[model samples]
Target chain A: MTTDAAVELAGVTKRFGDVVALDRVDLRVPSGVIFGFLGPNGAGKTTTIRLLTGLARPTSGEVRVLGREVTSAGFEVSSRVGYLPDVPAFYEWMTGEEYLAFVASLFGLESSVAKKRAGVLLEAAGLAGVRTRIGGYSRGMKQRLGIAQALMNAPALLVLDEPTSALDPIGRKEVLDMIEALAGKATVFFSTHILSDAERVCDEVAILDRGRVVANASVDEIRSRAGRKVALEVAGDVERVERAVAAAAWCRGVTRVGARIEAAVSDPGSAQRDVPAIVAAAGAGLVRFETVEPTLEDVFVELVERAS
Target chain B: MRGFRPFFLKELREIARTWRIWVLPSIVVVFALTGPVLAKVMPEILRSMSSEQLGGAVISLPEPTWKDAYAQWVKNLTQIVTFALVIMLGGTVASEVRSGTAIMVLTKPVSRPAFVLAKAAANAVLVTATTLLGAAATWAVTLAVFGEAPLRPIVQPTAAWLAWALFLVAVMTLASVLVQSPSGAAGVGIGVYAAISIASLSRWAVEHTPAGLIGAPGALLAGDRPPLSWPLAATALIAAAALAGAAVLFARKEL
Candidate 1:
């Protein structure tokens, strides 16, 4: 394990019989950062969460969480970490307070201390003054309570599995706020299929696709790595303009979809300077010309495409 | 052993709040109050009902005694209470796993062994508590109905039956941990119970295994002497082994 890492997975391969869920996956999340694990559905996001939390063992490789091997894992790491599985289920008979109190007890908290923490967390999760049992809670309410219970111990590391995958826009924003507020307080590692949610809160992210880590870097680094796309719409000879733009030394790749030509540039500065001139020489009216900053979604799609 | 205290307390609370609170204890308490009364009046009720059915012919029946009251209580426990225990506890572990509740608890600082042991301990305590209450009720009703109720006779068979009941609890615990569906676990539990009951026909099996205690209760209530120490020890040993097996299996199991 790295000295500063809160989680490290080295060449981890997890297979269920013949089907590989995670293929030689490696990830290192630093301490005190909200690390986003971004992937599409069935992209080994949940499988990695299981391995990192000691809920499942990898087929072959080392998994270290908080400097302890999670395969031989025990309360040593568990005591310091709090985890919320996706769509977390609770004792339907327990109220939000009661569930948090029960979670507090699992951490060996004193009764008085547990009660105090439960009260505070319930308030923060917007569950205060609601004493109804969990069975009657809405999906959004249960999700909030799930986050509250995971925070009962004030753990050093918080792991949430697709915390916002099932929530509405408002609920997702609230959860992202709760997670973002934990910055510098704990190492927050949350997996999500929502790219915007990752871009909104995470300082670093690893994008997984078909059991492989396609990209892992800070949001800005990954965006810059994908570089920039200069997309332009011409009023005439769109295919001819796409060919001319593709043949330019400055344009790495160009695609024509209808009238717009979106080109991947080796250097955004040169492409931004030369795109207009190239379109003018081709005798095309430049209806729209703009340098598009590559989004995390763009990077994800590009990487997953390349990896495939 | 870590986290057993809180988890056991939570289990007890769940038992009190869920359908579990109504199922097993309702059967035990209702039977305790009614079984002995039925035992005392069964002859008269049969005589009246069978007179017309018998076409005016008379039938003979043994006079009822305090032993009959013990027999009544034991009968209800063996037939209804044992089956109820299997069905009630069958989902104790599996339902948690199916509902994803076990993931919430097990992912914490709680060890998997502690989770299994806590559930077993809670069920044991619940069984012991209700059995003791039902026994006291049986004794009181027997005294009121038949006047010569010696406490020793009631105590003896109740203890013997309770040992068997606790063993069933252990078996159901193993079944609950082994099967993922509540109904399937109950089926497995009942199948084991049926197998053991069928094995009780052999004198050697009855004298040496938990199946022995099934009939030992009747013998003790009837003042017939039968060897009990072997079955008692055997049931305890096997119950312990089942519990240990449950804990070990639960530890290795995936969520």
Candidate 2:
């Protein structure tokens, strides 16, 4: 295990009777970076998070957090890891302050230290001046409070399972902003099916498909390796422009979308050189021609499709 | 045992905020206060009705004593307080599991055994305290209403009843850990209680199992110096075993 790795799993397999939730999954999340576990629903993302948090034991192989075996060093390792489940529930009677203080007490923090930290975290989560009971808060407020409680101990690794999954757009943005601000403070390992959210804030991502890690790399690496997309708008004879682009050797695939031709190209330089000439020869007026940066969505779809 | 104090404190807080703290204790106290008053008023109530129902025939009977008052209190505890205990603690662990609250807390430094122990300890402390307060109230009322009853008679029976209460709470905690729903937990608890009560009808079971403890209080209040019975030992053993069993099962639970 690398010293800088915050979480490590080696050939970990978790089975519930005849069903295999995670199949021989291997992963390494380095410290001090935001790592995104991207997958569709029922893709075992939550199962993997449970294993890392020591809430569930793997059927086989080793699971480690902070370089310690999770099964044997459960509490010792858990002390350094903060986790938030998908739907976090709190005591409805507890106010935001009371709940955080309760969580801090579990971590054995002194009362004074816990009080100061709770104040800072509440402000960071935008829950300052909210003295109402948790049951009275909206979904967004509860989610924000969930984050504050998870950060009560200032854990070295914060594992959030779909923190923003059920939130509105505004709530999603609020949570994402809070996660983005924790970039250098802790290693965040959050799971999400929303590729755009991962792309917006995650430094590195691992895409899981049907209980296995299909793709794992830095966001930039995946984007660059997924190749580039080029779009062309032709003013005349759009069909002819599409046919020309489809027949071009440099283009991987081409399809006409509305009045434009979109193509996936492995070689951007060659496609840029060859596409315009082909369109012009086909007697079509080229209105717009530009290469588009590949998105995480594109990479995710391609990887999952290939794995299946 | 790590996180015992924090978890226990949280359980206590929950009991205080919710109706469990006041409702169960209030019920017990009300029953205790009414027991002696009911015992004292029975003859007067019957005499008034006898003139009309029996054509002016006077019904004669001996006056009620402190023993009768104590017996009335024990009867209420066995029937009413037992049900209250089961309902109050039925969802102690199951609700937390269903709501995903257990997941959040258990993922921290808290051990599963510590969580179970804290929950059991908190419920035990609450039930024991309230029962004792109710017993004290009964003793004071009986002494004022009836002339000069010794403290030993009331104290002995109250101790016996408290032991049985502790056993019931342990069983309820185990049931909560075993089942997934609050109602299911209560069903198991009440079922086990009924089964034990039925089993106690047999002479062999009365001498061997914890079932004998429930009736011990009533018998003691009637001035029967029943020798230190095997069921008393069995009750204490079963309570400890139930707590240990709960901790073990909770540790293996997936959530």
Candidate 3:
């Protein structure tokens, strides 16, 4: 908290014609962490990235990255930042190594050092042995090369838009590992519709819905905000069991299946203490009783659905 | 112009590695070789055709000269090479934007002005090199075919045409920025060219505007000196203005 923030947006509102893409969205990401910007398609995640990268201007608000206002930075601030769009494109005639070298030249990297750095990055990206032109590459290979191209500068802040959106399971895992390896070296802000990928690597996440930010906090804190859910299974009189808990002070809502009942509880401690006894009094043997924690996906769906 | 050198080099490499290298240079080479040969054979062709159509009627026609050969070369370069040049350079910025390649470069420390000016400079080199190559070929062949041809006469007209071609490069650069598609940008370029040709029909327009440069090449090669200062200065000013306008507007576009 003492260090300066990596990115900050205050009351950012972007509109394309009459459609509002992002509406008064405000967020702050601290430096030296992996932050996730999670949303479904059409949730304005890319719009936010465009503003931060100076590819776009907001209808009304301030967008700052690494402590400099975006529009003012123009070219100078980009030296310390790297970005990968959702669909990264390249010159079809260029070989993988040639493209990286071109990117390095833009950053003013020396020839000798640039080649070595490019080799190391290509190796890390799993494209070291490939010598074909970029036009001949598959989608996955292109994505790997894209990651390599973005790292040519060793930027202080890396912004990625859906880095794993097109990868297979194994490829996604390797990319996630690469992102996990970059936790302290740079501030990695990545957006994804896949909640599990964000859940796996992010220290904090913000869920956006319908052009609005519904939740922004650490993973555990957001999970806690979904409250606690309890499921109980009994031998007999499941309807009586549901009736007993539905009227309790701690229970928020209850749903009964054929022989089991699930309920949301405001106080997990009170529910754990009282639910078993209440079920026994309703003449049903308590076969199972447990409190379940919501996964990040469950939390995301709950938050987004509630906002909608 | 923070990243001008590297960006410009990349553009040159792109031109060499793609189909762009083949189109303009090949067009000029073909025209340069054939223009003189066609000029030499035209009188005989007309005599042969008229003998059959006019039933052996006598005819008097002047002998073709190196001037005819040189004029044919200039006409082809101006009418045909200019269109090819337009189609070739029209997508300089638009294709990059559509293909998302601009995003890759613009995200670096490269300035917008540098991105646009790099394309302009690199394509200008291509246009200049090919035009000069064609002119040299025509000069050598015209001398060989006609037994006598002056180098100064050939050089003057080619220089004027080169000025107009380079100005078209700047026009296409701005067109690519204003229009998002390659063909659409080329359409804008051709429309401007047609407009200028039509406006040049006026005597005053030919004497004062860039339309003057369009016909200046033929007149200069025939050993007639026009008031060229106005057209040359106009070409330079307009080209510079188009480039500066492209840079300023591209900087504000929401990619």
| lDDT, each prediction | 0.89, 0.89, 0.91
How many angstroms is residue A224 displaced in model 2 relative to the true structure, after the best TM-score fit?
A: 2.0
What does chain B score (TM) in every candidate? 0.95, 0.95, 0.96
User: TM-score (chain A) of candidate 3?
Assistant: 0.93
Best by lDDT, which number? 3
Could you tell me the TM-score of chain A in candidate 1?
0.93
Candidate 2 CAPRI-style tier? high
Model 1 backbone overlap count: 0
lDDT of 2 by residue, B141-240 (tens): 8888886667888889888889888998899989999999999999999999899999878877877888778678888887887544688888889999
For each candidate, report its DockQ versus the true two-chain complex.
0.85, 0.82, 0.78
Q: Candidate 1 docking: what grade?
A: high
For DockQ, the strongest prediction is 1
Which candidate gets the maximum TM-score versus the true structure? 2
Q: Candidate 2 has which clashing residue pairs, if any?
A: none
Q: Is candidate 1 or candidate 2 better by TM-score?
A: 2
Candidate 3 ranges with C-alpha deviation above 4 Å: A1-3, A232-250, A254-262, A273-289, B52-61
lDDT by residue for model 2 over A1-308, one digit each (tens)? 66679989899999999999899999989999999999999999999998898888999989888889998996788899888889989988999999999999999999999999999998988888888999899988989999999899899999999999999999999999999999999999999999999999999999999899988889999887786889989888888888878777777888787888899987789889998798889888888999998899999999989988
Model 1 Cα lDDT, one tens digit per residue, B69-108: 8888988888889888988888868988999999889889
Tens-digit lDDT string for candidate 1 (A21-78): 9999989999998999998899999999988878888889999999889867678998
Clashing pairs in 1: none
Candidate 3 Cα deviation (angstroms), residue A182: 0.6
